[model samples]
Target: MNCKFLAIAVAVILFCRPGHAQTGATVLDDFKPSSLNQPGQEYPQVNSQGYVRFRIEAPKAQSVVVSLGLGGTRGGTPLTKGTDSIWTGTTAGPMEEGFHYYHVTIDGGVFNDPGALNFYG
Candidate 1:
């Protein structure tokens, strides 16, 4: 019993260890829905600094990716799947100001943000 208790304590400490933290970066709290957002939709938003954040719902998807800033670093940002069936992530850096096109790829399939309006250009 004592041995088991000691093992449990060690495991707890290891599990609770802090992860590498971010430094010297501040994301402003001034995010707003993009002008391309459909009425009443607000998942894909952009901050004043041009950082784009995306939220996609795909509970069973094995992977999710956005085409924003493609061919750039990390081949675009990948969304982390959450327990609530939603995948979310932010751009690695601020995007260029002006119109940019992006789409979501889930589990090898491509789809558009339901909250965003589509354009043909």
Candidate 2:
């Protein structure tokens, strides 16, 4: 029993050590508009690393959030409003490759992204 307890304690310590988490690789700046975007839209871009970036123009909105992150387990990716009155944000991490359904929340009301082509289901 003592041996088992000692092993468990060591494992916990190793896992909790600082800098033992994800790598510190920087997110590249190379991003392009998603192919699913509307014909002249420029936002909702995807980077090579599979990170998704969103930009929404809602000058009067109090808050804006994107419903695309961690498979929707987390509420969503909250955007920060810039001085230009445009809200923007990036996913916390790289997302799995493939099509993903997402929507925007402006001032608490959910709405589809005007820049992105609508996809049912």
Candidate 3:
């Protein structure tokens, strides 16, 4: 009886271990407007984990994508068009802390985010 109890305890400990018990990734809902955003703009937000989210309004646009993702090598983060004609998307993974430059591509036309402040170097 003692051996059976010990085996059960060991199994429970292993099953309850951190990282092993989680069934899926957790993305925090707490996000705020980016510091670089233009006044009154709510999009181009960043989360605590460095995940950036964008919301653009282009009612007739065919496709919208942000030029920021996976160290800027994996094309970019593609935004999905919602029923309201808004394009929104979040980065696949957390980005490195600090400033990063990006642009928006709408229907094959590249353009800067109108909501964000422009940065020139």
Candidate 4:
């Protein structure tokens, strides 16, 4: 029981740390604070009200899904093509304003969010 409690406590402390700690850098620096939002933009590059957003610099895909976890959200949002093969969308949140892990999925597959820091949760 004591061992279990100790392990639990350690896990809690690590989980409480800002989601970007996995990268060994600050989330603010990771996200480029200055690029949080552009003048007259619909959403922020980083947002509290919405989830993290990203775009890939790849040619148009037959399909794409941005998985929230290192693996993928059991059921995550699928990416819709934006102009120039850019994909965009938000996640089901309850997420605090900070960095989180994610990956891109092309054609019903999952990939790590190469641009963002990743955590196992």
Candidate 5:
């Protein structure tokens, strides 16, 4: 009888403990963007005329394209090599003020910039 009481007590103690005591609740973040292209930044490389310029860093990519809405798809001009694993492109003209999308086309794959903070429809 004493052994039965002890076994029941042990079972109650084990089941009564809070679940968080073993594993706490967690907040999960799904780090997936809706698009492979990135949105334009609020600020770009400004020229003397104060036209904001945009820069896309894709040194590994043989071909990078920036599609500016209404402005058209601008190819990666003056691609320069860098120390890191990347290929870069710059535009001669300042990016027109508006919504834009860009992707680094590498080996026929498009990727979004994790650092960029913009998105397009």
Candidate 6:
């Protein structure tokens, strides 16, 4: 019957739609290097949505972390090392729009981000 064919068509259309049903807010693809970055630096960038992304390079380091605007029990966004020996990660959520102090933790030692301009805080 036409009803049966119509039902099948509707099911196919629903199933073939692009992307799975998402239950989360979408992050816009608008990110740029922060104004506080050192000349020609690009790692410490901020997006229009206020999310912060960090990238650090340390080949011999066991672990790397950014003590920035991350909000959780861990207190920071942990960077995962890639094959290129650079560590990178993004904040779980958007950060407040303003100046904030942060540092990198490499193998349990705190160090300033070379890409970012250092503030004597």
The TM-score that candidate 4 achieves is 0.47
Model 2, runs deviating above 4 Å: 1-24, 71-74
Q: Which stretches of candidate 1 lie over 4 Å from their true place?
A: 1-24, 70-73
Error of 4 at 58 (Å): 2.9
lDDT of 1 by residue, 12-117 (tens): 9855656312235687868889988999988789998777888887888999989895335566779998878899988866776888888888888998888799
lDDT of 3 by residue, 12-118 (tens): 98656664322255768899999989999998999987788999999999989999875245589999999999999988777767788989999999999998999
Every model's TM-score? 0.74, 0.77, 0.76, 0.47, 0.38, 0.76
lDDT by residue (56-118, candidate 4, tens digit) is: 545657876666532244456565677777676544342455555556778766776545444
- lDDT of each structure? 0.81, 0.86, 0.86, 0.53, 0.44, 0.85
lDDT of 4: 0.53
TM-score of 3: 0.76
Candidate 6 backbone overlaps, count? 0
**Residue 9 lDDT, candidate 6, scale 0-100:** 100
Q: Can you give the lDDT of residue 60 in candidate 1? A: 88
The CA lDDT at 13 in model 1 is 85
Relative to the unseen true structure, what is the C-alpha lDDT of residue 116 in candidate 2, on a scale of 0 to 100?
95
Between which residue pairs do clashes occur in model 1?
none
Worst 10 residues of 1 by lDDT: 15-24
Q: What are the RMSD figures for all models against the true structure? A: 15.3, 7.5, 12.0, 9.6, 21.5, 13.7
lDDT of prediction 1: 0.81
Error of 1 at 77 (Å): 1.3
**Tens-place lDDT digits, model 5, residues 74-113:** 4443344457744443343433444456544455666664
